[model samples]
Target: MTTTLKISPIIGNSQARRAAAASFFGSMLEFYEFFIYATAASLVFGHIMFPEESDVGALLSLATFGVAYIARPLGALIFGHIGDTIGRRATLIISLIMMGTATVLIGFLPTYHQIGIAAPIVLVVLRILQGISAAGESAGSASLTIEQAPEGRRGLFGSSVTSGVAVGFVLASLVFLPIMALPEEDLLAWGWRIPFWLSSIILIVAYFIRRRIEEPEVFAESRRTGHTSKMPIVAVVRDWWRDLLRVTGACLFLAVQALMTVFALGYVPATTTITSSDMLWVWIIANAVSAVLMPVAGMLSDRYGRKPIFITGCISLAVSVFVFFNAVGTGSLLLVGLAGVLTMGVCYSFANGVYPAFFPEMFNVRVRYSGYAISLQLGLIVTGFTPTAAQSLVGVGVGPAWFLPATLGAALALVAAATAWTAKETAHLPLHELGTDRNLRLGKRRIS
Candidate 1:
């Protein structure tokens, strides 16, 4: 007697679409919590949490903001291990809950005047929880989307994760726009907490959606074969170190995001004539535009290849940072908004769109989360401090008129661009074959 083994059909395109939508909405909520804190740190926290000396207060507030990134590596390690060993669905659901809890706690916490240094200390601890929760978010979502995506459209589906980030920023700014318009006393006292508290609704919605998602097929296969890494950290360090370095180098593009969305808002208000509301409206518009453009760019990468699109974005972002800061110096809202849109919406979208597919594709399935999470978080630590570093470098007219910060941001973009160019082109490769160094034998000619 002969026995036949049947393979299940690949998940349908409609199911992939549903999964992508779920991943996108969940990511939007997660990042809304993350970016809102960054916005509040740049705008309100200095006054309410560290009201002593102006510069020092700003630095301390930003430091508390940076504390989250420090926790990101730990989050990455813990969550990445779970993602590789257990499943993406469980890890993402837990991350959403942790982030929501931390954010709501932040909204309820007492200010420095009410509770002294304990307020800032508690804020820092909550921020750390937010960071850890965020560490697994993009990687988990991207991994899930890529595994489920229809053939030849992984780039487009995966890009939704990054697009969700911009959408989240837009939502965050829009949510806070009215709140920030309140009287200064009211805003610092109460209005500022509203956005953080609203995160509970997002958490509930995300949890419901994410719980419906099944584990990705790739991860399930790894588990069945017992191919899952016993120690994801050890596997990442031993097998995928090169990809880790490349991804970390590439993640520096995040500094452009941090600087534009966080530091620039603070810098413009302090140095120029722009109000916080005006600056936030600029963010709202830029991120809204990015939400539209990121998918288009990701689609383009499918045809023209990821390297060119990724390189162009990095170089353009670097150049645009200087142009944007100079536009802010002009103190014209029109010019400032244009600069924000160009940098965040157009230029940054290239990197943002491609990285969701690009970074994870550089690692084998067994260690994909570990490699992507660790490298991405390490690079993010640098970006998290960009605002504080930019502030120190901009002291009292001794520096180069915003040139120093802009230059540093551009330099990081350049590093990302170079790293992208050096990476293997995986556009035409099948998902199973990705992340390996192999030669394609075409018509008797071998191509890498």
Candidate 2:
């Protein structure tokens, strides 16, 4: 369908700031739950939830981590509709609660020894719930923040969402550092639970912030004028399928993130002398730098254009995979740390910072939430399996096969860069004209 959008007066900066803060904190809560589960899977879940040997348990744990990705697209569809029809603020609140609830219950769950096969099954179910919560978290937050942002500064405001992601990784790492130091029995039995339990505190804080948020004036106007699509998913697929595919391909840049953060945590320590503790420090340093620089990347994208920053990130990440793995092979903590900072904190932030603004800007307000969430989550399904897939690629042991996964990540990054190169630059476009008209002539219906 052909869709046209009308511009609305910009809301007050105070409200926009509130929306950004809310989105930032809410994203923080969501990803904090996410990384903690990842950390637990890598460090604890397999032993606790499965009857298999350590290797099998670890694989199962990683598989549970990927299981959530499978449910994310379903979450995107359900929450996307709620976000588009009911309102962004409410959808964000509901999503945060779902994530928090799942994380906390996981903290309290019974082990396989205590409950037989039920433990892993329950864990997988909870992970799926987490996947669903995450489906809405970033997309809703990005859409809310960008829509509220001043015309020239959506990139800057949108950066807050990804900044939260960086901070979440930092928090997850820091929380685990002390826990990781505990005696092995205690570490497995109780220490890992602390981080998940901490979500209760974050949930309360994020809930209050989100409660204060108001809908963006643009979206409010869309509702008043009845400009909303009756079936946003149907509309987005019918009119914007190409954009959806482009977004999915561009999102493969996340393979860089998956290999760098999640897979490396397992791979580097096992094959080399580097300890998991050392890797956690690397992650902390990288993400701390990323949390700071992401906003800078966003501000730069505002001036330079989204495609340049995004494509640059993809290229940098592709190159850095070789450098990072080389550093790992050398067993130099400093080299590895520096490479991690460059690959994740600096390079990946460029794309991560801009995408919140870039993706949603491709769709009119009527289908923006559905389009952004569905496309983003669809790509993430593959990303979620990267660590597991990487492990499988190594066969019996890591050996020189570590490079295999790194090479795979680099290739995906290049593919994302190429896909991004083909997209129209949305940074300087007026909000109402953000999407393309390349497919307009093929539409059978018109949306006004």
Error of 1 at 424 (Å): 0.9
Best by TM-score: 2
Clashes of 2: 0
Q: Over the stretch 1-448, how does candidate 2's per-residue lDDT look in tens digits?
A: 2232232233367788999999888888887887888888987887888985555888888999999999999999999999998799899999999988999999999889899999999999999999999999988999999988888899999999999988988888898899999999998888889998998998999999999999887788888988777788987898888888888889899877877777888888888888999999998888999889889989998999999998998898899888898898888888999998988888888888888898888877878899999999998888999889888877445556667788889998999899988888888887766654633566635553
For model 2, the stretches where C-alpha displacement exceeds 4 angstroms are: 1-11, 52-55, 395-399, 436-444
Across 1-448, the per-residue lDDT of candidate 1 in tens digits comes to 1222222334456667767887798789877986889888887898899756655787788888888889999999999999888888898888888888999999999998999989888998899998998898877888888877766788898889988888888889889899988998999999999999998887887788887888777778878988777787886776667778888999998888888777887888888888888988888888888888888888887878888889999999999998898898788989999998999989999889988888888877777887788999999999889888887767535544688888889999999999888888866678878754521222322111
Give the worst 10-residue stretch by lDDT in candidate 2.
1-10
Please list all clashing residue pairs in model 1, or write none if there are none. none
Name the runs in model 1 displaced over 4 angstroms.
1-10, 51-55, 395-400, 438-448
Q: Which consecutive 10 residues in model 1 have the weakest lDDT in total? A: 439-448
